[model samples]
Target: MFKINNLSVKFIILIILFASLIFGCTNNKINQIEDLRKNNNELNKTDTSSSPTKLTPKNTIIDLENTDSEERLLNNIFSSVAPSVVHINITKEMDVPSNQNIPDSFGFNFGIPDEPEQYFERGEGSGFVYDKEGHIVTNYHVVENAEVLEVSFIDGLTVKAKYIGGDPDSDLAVIKVLSDPSILYPVQLGNSDNTFIGQRAITIGNPFGQTWSLTAGVVSAVGRTMRSGNSAFSIPEMIQTDAAINPGNSGGPLLNSNGEVLGVNTMILSQSRSSSGVGFAVPVNIVKMVVPNIIANGTYIYPWLGVTLSNISLDIIDAMNLDLKQRGALIINVFDDSPAANSGLRDSQKNIEVSGGTITIGGDIVVSINETEVQTSDDVISYLVKYTQPKDTIVLKVLRDNTIIPIEVILDPRPGK
Candidate 1:
């Protein structure tokens, strides 16, 4: 300031302007804060009691005093069915691989055991009491080749079980435990045919070796077809659910909201070998049909036509010069000596390529079974399982050479039955 150059004078003026701007902004902020405080005071003084508005957000509101009825029902179901549910412990003999011959550094030979060593592989699954006679319903795979079976009840009572009968076609097995009648709570079997999609589905099982675990979901689908790993036949009228069924859940009861047994939890579709929410159960109707037969005999005899059937595809339709809307079960191959073969039912003789792949055509397309209209192979299988029995003569209305022809076939017991 004492020796004022032109630059020094400009710098002094800039400092004065910046100081004025800061003071002005400070004053304005103080006024705005005071106004906000006044508005808050006015709002607080207002009579909120007259309107009675909820201060909390609607989504965050909690009904602490009230209990959800569905939740209570779930709890009730678990309590009532826990006694009927059982933990099945399996002991299977596994062949341990023998080591190959190895030579030491000194060229000395070391020989492995001549016979492979065997060890017991322990596994567990779940089951439900089927009757007062101590018959426990479970999956056949659960007890397949099982050397020893031990069943544990909710009361911590463990008893040895003997496999009475098993049907691999239906994946159902009956194991009898000599337990007290008082401890055996047979689950009420529900009619799976009456089940509908979106109906509540519940499961009581031992998932991942954890016993008595309960899961809840809804029926994803009904009347589904699931291929059996134990047989060449497919299980029809299956119940599909989103229920979390894991490794140890096989053979457990898939229940309804009323605690009635709807199906037997059999398998799940997953990459991790655990529940990915796509689980399937053998319908109780199939259980009703198969279990009694298994108990009476060693196996359940399924009605077989011995024809490998395929759904009519677009390629097949085009190859056969059929309507685009044509739907039926196409006869792919008729096994020799089968009912279909003996009845003169024809198989596909021509091959045609489609967008997907090559397909066989010129086969007799099954349009109806026993006078019932069939749209696909599933209809035929379901009809066989539900209505026809082995040795029963049935008529199939088939589309052959653009003409419907009726063929009578006497059903035979499925192979390996």
Candidate 2:
């Protein structure tokens, strides 16, 4: 009986201990599950807060507003600049022989011709008000030989304008209208030297007689040269753009996004005599230089170098034994008693046949002028025409007999000044 009682007590003690252990383990697992649930909730909250919001109607509205702002900018530019634009019409008189043949019945016809008949030829172009003095700036070709000039504003106001002056070398001209200063809106000039390719370019002009037409594009290129119509000289440092400029658009202002004048629409490269997505403008910097001179003088005097120049090419290099890498303007013929001759510059001694044709030899090659590289004849011409004037002295780095020499020449007015 004693043994049985002891065993029963021991079994009871073991059951109590085992029950405590099982309950303790269940509580611990519950705590672990709770901690895991808390961590997962925090992670989900963070993900929800960090993810991008779905695009909604509000975002669409914002995009529309941005587009509207761009439209407003272009509209504002046009409104401010169109008033300064003008339509110019010119009439010229020409003499042509009369079509009437001498009647044989009148006399033994001394083959003398009949009196010439006078007729009026008309042309149209565009221009802009330049200043408060009612001065207008335009292309020289626009007002060339103009006997009568009629200037029309955007508001249907027309006035008779007189030719002030012009410079064909720059293809720029100025005219004056005797109008009230209150009616004239002068355009602001922008610094074209700061212009970059792909910047916004705007133009306002009369194209095909459509007055005050507006076009927009980006600057396609800078520092270009174009020859004036049938002229030996070329307009240099032109701004090329894809603006829709046509025949009558000549002389109109090319503006920047700020409505400031960046250039003057001059010409277009097209086979159909229309816009071919390639139009050129005389840079505003050149306009600034030439306009003031045109207003004071009747014509611009180009600085004369008095030498025919040829570009250094591979053929000339091989024929003259010149350095293959050297590029410059080759002096072909220095005129007598001219600035080049007075400066003791040497010209070509002879012409020799090369692979490319006849190449001139025995001439001093101009490598640099006034610290500017003279890589071609155009470079020398453009640099002198833009930066130097008559009586100005320029330093030329010349290459002679494989020796570099510096020559100083005092510029003179263009031949036949």
lDDT, candidate 2, 117-202, per-residue tens: 77799999999999999999999999998999999998899999999898877789999999999989999999988888998999
lDDT of 2 at 411: 93
The per-model lDDT (C-alpha) reads 0.92, 0.89
lDDT of 1: 0.92
Q: How many residue pairs clash in each candidate?
A: 0, 0
Candidate 1 clashing pairs, residues 3+ apart or interchain: none
Best by TM-score: 1
TM-scores of the models, in the given order? 0.82, 0.77
Clash tally for model 1: 0
TM-score of 2: 0.77
Give a tens-digit lDDT track for model 1, residues 286-375.
999989888888778888899989998777777889989998999999999999999999999888777888888878999999899999
